[model samples]
Target chain A: MEIIKIGMADLGVAKPPSRLRTTGLGSCVGVVLYDEVHKVAGMAHVMLPESTLAKNGEPTVGKYADTAIPYLIQQMQKEGASIRHMVAKLAGGAQMFAFLGTNDMMRIGPRNVEACKLALKGAQIKIVAEDTGGNCGRTIELDSTNGVLQIRTVNQGVKEV
Target chain B: MANFTKFGDFQFDVLREIGNIGAGHAATALSKLMQKEIDMKVPQVRIIPFDEVADCVGGAENVVVTVFLRVEGDSPGNMFFILDMDSATHLLHQVTGISKTVQEWEEMEVSALHEIGNILTGSYLSSLADFTQLNLQPSVPGLAVDMAGAILSYGLYALGQTGDFALTIDTAFFEGNDQVKGNFFLIPDPDSLPILFRSLGVPFDGDY
Candidate 1:
């Protein structure tokens, strides 16, 4: 009945009548997993590629692609969504600054996308749609009722996948 | 990760003073460029969660103009000069006399803004180096007109690795009747915190 908002390095799951949303994704991937049969959806705003890259203490499970995808799957399954019935849609992971090429961090956007794809493949979840890898920021929302992902950008307007 | 959460009032005050010196030099440079007087607000030093970082600049999706620089050398961090649409328009008009509505940035406007950012951030860094007596270097400025969330997050990768929270020293300044307003943000990497404090002769709680 309400929208569940996810912040940076966070994830959430919802059932019918509830939607999942994350805004202002730049060089960060927004991964959505949905089960149309169960009307369930889960989303994560992933900031980095791997959890192993963390130099300090343990990071949150939702912050890295290696951990977030599996965690999202497990959360959705608790809501009656099965991995077999679930499909994935992705948005975000855009390089906001083009001239920051010297730093290895500049490759983070594409690396995030690559890592997400690898994680989804490991789970055998087919990516039904994607809007990724550009020089812009995106806000994405997933509708649990019909398994649609809507992406919005500053210059490109809005599109539903 | 840094135990910045354990910081005391004195630590925050020291950070505030750091922002003050850096932004003060930048403001003086800006005043000279425009030949007008400018006033700066007191700097604010905050340690906030990532989700709330964008709220400091309007919001995540708010359209903004930003000039970004990567500070390297003894103290590594990210530097951002953010301006709203009105401020960007006002700036372009003052510097170049191109008074067109700033819906989309032309090549010339982008170049002018980039140069301004280079000059201001250059001065900002040089003055900080003078104060702390540390060797600080800034990368070439990169200009972008985009959503604030997207632009600002680009500066977060280093800090995001260690923890969910970010420490930023921010200063806002006004130009001539407060029509043109901009903010200067210095987000030092987690590893650089101790180096910064040691240079300023402030005691960092090593146990924390």
Candidate 2:
């Protein structure tokens, strides 16, 4: 089976006999959207909560939760996946460090999770499973064939949802 | 994204020098702490894509022990002291005589590693502050043993909102002929670049 790799602040979609994978997500979040009927899966490794938070010229669509989710959906739609049949699985918004309270960016892990959930809700997509908000980093993969989302961490081994 | 493409060789040299000054002091402290000579390498300053940042130490999935601290004054940024699994074990063995593997580490081990990071990073920043005449302070150091990508990316989010690329100053450490190896990474926020340049008497705005 082919595994499509998504880099940080990046996204990709895969068809049957393929998997979408992203690794070592700490403060970032990994979001998966699957259309079970069509066997299409999309994954995004988003680095921040909102595109509006960008301080320079706009970053790529996959860099933030608000922008990445919609962009991933649009890409999946173009791949013959229907929005009505889509469901989401989420992982990897971890507070890797203790709360310092001085910089708001230090709390980015939880904010990324909340932002992804809000974006999914705005798109009217149902979230089937999520493994988020912890002090550990995670690597995640989504299989297009069975819509199984697998998450791996340093201490906790692989778990599927 | 802040434009790293426009950076010139002179600007990069400045950054490399900054890394040298900081890590030089840090290495001296480490050498004294371990009572073993620590070898230093010429610093590498680069503007790397977010995905490739973790590749500096190893792959994204590679497990590492990291000491993270936030720099909160003058030129605010992030600092990380990273060690691979084997190096972490060896460091513990050499420093505290704890010959246990990373899996066998307990609270005392964790606290020991955290203090080492704090002392080393504190030395790195104080030396830099003295040289630049800039008020730079580090938050209490935090320690985590996990995937390199996960740990490194925590430092990237502040820059993530501003750009697709991170400008990093990296200094490699090898203790007594590579017995223990580690990496010192200093990633400054984009906004701080100008402040850093100005503090050093380097012109912030000019064509190169």
Candidate 3:
């Protein structure tokens, strides 16, 4: 069992015999793209929603879902994975802040989840499962060999995504 | 109502001082973490009633990173760190030293970002402790999705009140051409508000 642990500001790609995992996702979005036929999987833990916001083009590569998802897809395709057979699973998007008053526009978790869905939809990838939106944080795991996604929230038992 | 107004101003002043000291420490820590010269300005402080935070923060279109901390001791209260996404990602990259072009969003990177939150929240809370002469131990910093509504809602829910006073600090970090903007909110209930004010030596008369 080869376990590839993905880190913040980093992405991991694995082939059939490899599995990828990321933990403690709060506000940040974790994405898993898997091709069952080729037994290939890729995971991205994005901090922000879009790279264009990064501007300067200096560090815009995979920081946002807009850029990260496309890059993961291309990488998977290069490794003999077909987009037609690929499925997406996502987790994380917690609202962890407290505010007082009518200025409640700072809902980054739901926006992130929505943005991820939009990006995936634009790319024509089927989203099979998603565990998102809450006041609590989560951890996500992806198994490449079997294309299984597991999500666990704090104080909440692990469940399939 | 008059008493609440007076108390709000008093608390705001103390929170501003806290934000200044906290942001200064955060900048110093960030400079060390990034191994680059970093500059941060004293945050602009505002004590806003709950219903006007969105307007105060300019509508929250951009990304926001929020950290919730439960503070205990002499001055028991809650503190939140709300940062724009641009600043969050920039700070994340600077602290982690990950190549700017790598975009795969791996799990390790997310873990790395958590360390940034820990540092910022730790430094800020430590400053708060010094200002209020209170013992404040913050929990491990965690990330949350939204900035304005969700964080405020969650915070208020925890406090179980409709209207509360928030100390908001506007801050900026600059390193060469890279810059980031963020805010720190000190949400103390009405009762704790007076205690915080007296600690900071701000007089409260309930006027404006």
Candidate 4:
């Protein structure tokens, strides 16, 4: 099976027998959508919540949940997968530091989780499983063949969703 | 987000000098604490993508012990002191008489490492502030033993709003025989670049 690596603020789509993976998700969230019928999957390593937060002239779509989710859905459709049939599995929105206080940016992990949920809701996509929040960093892999998301953490070995 | 590409060679050299003074002070502080000679590599100033930021110390999945602090005041930004697990343990053993044989880090061991990071990073920033005459204050240091990517990403939030690229001033230090090694990464907020340069009487071209 081919393992496609997705970097931070990046996204990709793959078919059956190919897996999508992202490493070291701290405050960032990893959103994965899979269609068992077509064996198609798309993964995005979202660094922030909204594109409106961007101060750059041109912001990359895969960098934020607001842009990444819709873009990933479109890419999946291009791969012959129906949006309605795609199920989402989320992982890796974590507060890596615990004593950073209540600053909005300090709470980025939870905010990222909320943003991804709102975006997924707008697309009418249902989230089947998630492993998010807390103060640990996670590395996740989504297998297109079985629509399973494997979550790995430093202290907590590995679990499947 | 702040484009180091726009910074001319002279500007980069200035920044490198800034890192040098800061890390040099920090290395001295470490040596004083351990009573052992510590050497620091010349600081590097570069603009890098978020994906490659963790590669300086190791890979993204490489587990490390990091102390993170939010830099506030004239040149607001983020600062981090990162050490590999082995080095963290060694420093702890040398400083606190803690046993390094244990695989898992106990509470006291973690606390000892946190204090070391706090002192080292504090001296680094304080020396920079003194040199630049910029009112730079560091928030309470938060310690974490986790993947390098996860630990380092916390420093990127300020830059995330501007772009995927981050301008970093990195300094690496090691003890004799390579018993302990750690990295210092300082990422100033985009707007703070001009303020920092102005404080140093250096003219910065931001209209690229």
**Best prediction by DockQ:** 2
* Candidate 1 CAPRI classification by DockQ: high
Descending-DockQ candidate ranking? 2, 1, 4, 3
The candidate 2 chain B region of ten consecutive residues with least summed lDDT is: B199-208
Per-residue lDDT over B53-102 for candidate 2, one digit per residue giving the tens place of the 0 to 100 score: 99999889999999999998998999999998888888888889989898
lDDT at A59, model 4? 80
Of candidates 2 and 1, the better by DockQ: 2
Q: Candidate 3 lDDT, tens digit per residue, B59-146?
A: 4222356666655566656666666656667767767767442234456765676667678768877877787786667754555544
- Which ranges of candidate 3 are over 4 A from the true structure? A1-161, B7-12, B55-61, B100-104, B158-172, B201-208
How well does each candidate superpose onto the true structure, as a TM-score?
0.97, 0.97, 0.51, 0.98
lDDT of 1 by residue, A4-88 (tens): 9999999999887888999899999999999988888999999999999888787789999999999999998988999999999
Q: Name model 1 segments beyond 4 Å from true.
A: none
Task: In angstroms, give how far residue B9 of model 3 lies from its true place.
Answer: 7.0
Worst 10 residues of 2 chain A by lDDT: A96-105
Better of 1 and 3 by lDDT: 1
Docking class of 2: high
> Global CA lDDT of candidate 2, please?
0.90
RMSD of each: 1.2, 1.5, 16.2, 1.2
Name the runs in model 4 displaced over 4 angstroms.
none
